[model samples]
Target: MEKALVYINYPELIPLNDKSTEYDGYITIDDKFTYRIKLQVPNFPDVKNITYSGGRFHYIAIQEEDKLFKLAYYDIPKISSELLKEYASLNELFTTYCNCIEELQTYFDVMDSIDTVCWVIDPPKPKKSDYMRRIMIGHNVSIQITFDPLNILNLPQIQFMGSENGVAPFRESFINNLDNWDPEYDVVQNILRLIDLPFFPQEPTDAAKSNDLDFKVNECCICFCVQLENKLPDEICKNPNCEQCFHTDCLYQWLSAVGTSRQNFNLIQGECPNCKTCISCRIPNI
Candidate 1:
């Protein structure tokens, strides 16, 4: 099969009518057009043969114009499943994977945190270990975190360990440093905090309902996981008739399941899960 072509130069037919309008990157030729220059696939080292269910974590090399740019590892089960379902080849999968990460970068500000994005560890392969994949210098020690796709379900499953270097620092701290670190604690809280999640689950308190009118705000309309003390809702529907609230993550997942359409930043527009009221919903801006 002819690999997807990225026209790096303007075609002869479309002469430089306006030099000022020229762009720096590749110029895509339309389906009716054709070009000769084709990008060659950069050589990537083979991943160690390992067995796992769903999908395997991988350190992928990203290249452009035959130039090696960077390496990254991610829990790509969901993305891989999408690729397999689409019947994409290895090259197509790599390209699509890069494009997906780049697109996600624009959608979530949480991607800004390198500590939250990825964790680096020495793997079984020594020849491939040249530099840290992602890092930050702090307290005279460089703290790093590996980016994991939080789509997994359990705590132990989500805690990604390095092949040879053991676990990253953030996971270590959450386990050893944080006194309240429990399996019950939300796994996505660290990711949420980076995005400045607007509301937290409100804590439910004793005393009668008449004791404090603020008590009603404790329950999430979708999943009534209320607790004692103070917590907050991540987002509330703007619909006047349906003031139903939900955890932003919860709502986002629900929206993806039911929504027929999607907008920028991973937001979905469709009927409300509870009231069946059509609405455009997303994570709060702040």
Candidate 2:
């Protein structure tokens, strides 16, 4: 007898292509296992500014026959099928993937390789799709790539926002455009090395540093401690106009004190204490 494929039990995530109008309220897949890989380019410059560069973040869901997994923060340029076939087990596959990411990291001074978080998102209880969506389990990191040789000043400005507010056709196109999985072809190291980055990143000058301090006052919302440029912030409110930032450790303690346990995507979803704007806390591995 064939083994049963575990379903996510989240209807919203059901692929648009499925024909059934009334979903069983379960995310059934032909494949028993799947992978949701999230790549975040958190530090790209504004497109409206002289530096016209648009970074991409991708969420790839790969269907397999045995397990459900999620990986975060990467930009893969190529993948090879042979090595992937050679390493069929999860442990070997993960090791190979990390090796590729490490190789890619070596090519750029600023790009860093981080540990990929892995966990099984257990199936939700009946009528509890909302509950499942609220819980997240995994490591999160800021995936970055540098354009050291690209002359931002010379490029024409392109008015482009981001996928955070994704519309229909564009979102569909992006999902359809992801390259097919091949472990060997996905070596970004070789691709990035051949192409020169647009601009070499530099440390903030004294004048710029002074201006940043003057404008923001370098203060954290929770502890009132000075937030340096190099320090980690726990939460930054998603509101475009809001500028409130907080230390993760400080905010976590504050949230616990306040008894706000509401969470979404494994993050503490609540309003910023400073600006009253909503924020989601995904505490990094500090």
Candidate 3:
């Protein structure tokens, strides 16, 4: 089948089971969740030969220097027949898992001081020895289920691990689901109520609200003249109290009228752009 083109330039894309450098499709999921996870499979060595498996815990290590996360392994857990029916992959299951955790955290405000984002998955195999494909979640909480390692080893290599990306779609859907979930009024209301953030859900705003959103540096105080032909354009204004620097010639002409514009600075106690509080400044006359 013809594969799609990807424009990502991530240098550490390998060793994460990114399949042959030229390959651009789903990779295998070691026999765990019955192949529910299908995404960019990084190259993992020596995982398929063993069985004694159920659900595996997956790990993704943080690479601070490269700003990329390395593919850690997933610890697949033994899924009951009931769960397999509903979830295609563990990542899909996590959406509900995370949502429930978040809801519980926000509503109760007592997450046992443990970072709540932690849950079970396969752990990285390269860095650790005596690797177990047990389903363990959370860094702080070593919650895990035992597996039959000897039984897993008897499984055929091709059969033990799926060659295709079984869980990729579930990962894609779980991570990017928010792209389609727009924050409509009702969604916002439910989220606010469920998560209990301090956000005041306001209605459609008017033009007056725009003033708060302006990004211009309104409070600048320096004015200087520059040779635009030789460098950049020089501009000046008489509001010496303003932080905006002006061109020398422009400043001289504006102040030349009353001499009140000498190196002298004039300030008016005026209200600020947002809170209407009086702000004063001595504009630098350069």
- Comparing 2 with 3 on lDDT, the higher-scoring candidate is 2
Per-residue lDDT for 110-172 in model 1, tens only? 322322333221221212112222221121122233333332212222222111122244445
Candidate 2, position 155, lDDT: 17
lDDT, residue 246, model 2: 70
Quick one: best TM-score, which candidate? 2
Q: What's the C-alpha lDDT at position 12 in model 3?
A: 21
- Local distance difference test, candidate 3: 0.27
Instruction: Give the CA lDDT, 0 to 100, for residue 257 in model 1.
Output: 79
Total clashing pairs in model 3: 65
Residue 96 C-alpha lDDT in model 3? 33
Question: Would you give me the overall lDDT of model 2?
Answer: 0.33
Model 2 lDDT-worst window of ten: 45-54
Query: How well is each residue in 8-103 modelled by candidate 2, as lDDT tens digits?
Result: 223232322343221112211233322232211222210010110113222222223334322322234333442334323333444444444333
lDDT: the better of candidates 1 and 3: 1
TM-score of model 1 relative to the true fold? Answer: 0.25
Which tens-of-lDDT digit does each residue in 1-286 have in candidate 3?
A: 0112122322222332444323222222322222222233233321111111123223322111123222132223222232233333333443433232222322122111111222212232222122232211111112222223223212111111110132233234434543343334233222223322234322123664345332111211223322322222122122324324333333344444432333334532333322333333344344
User: What is the lDDT, from 0 to 100, of the residue 108 in candidate 3?
Assistant: 23
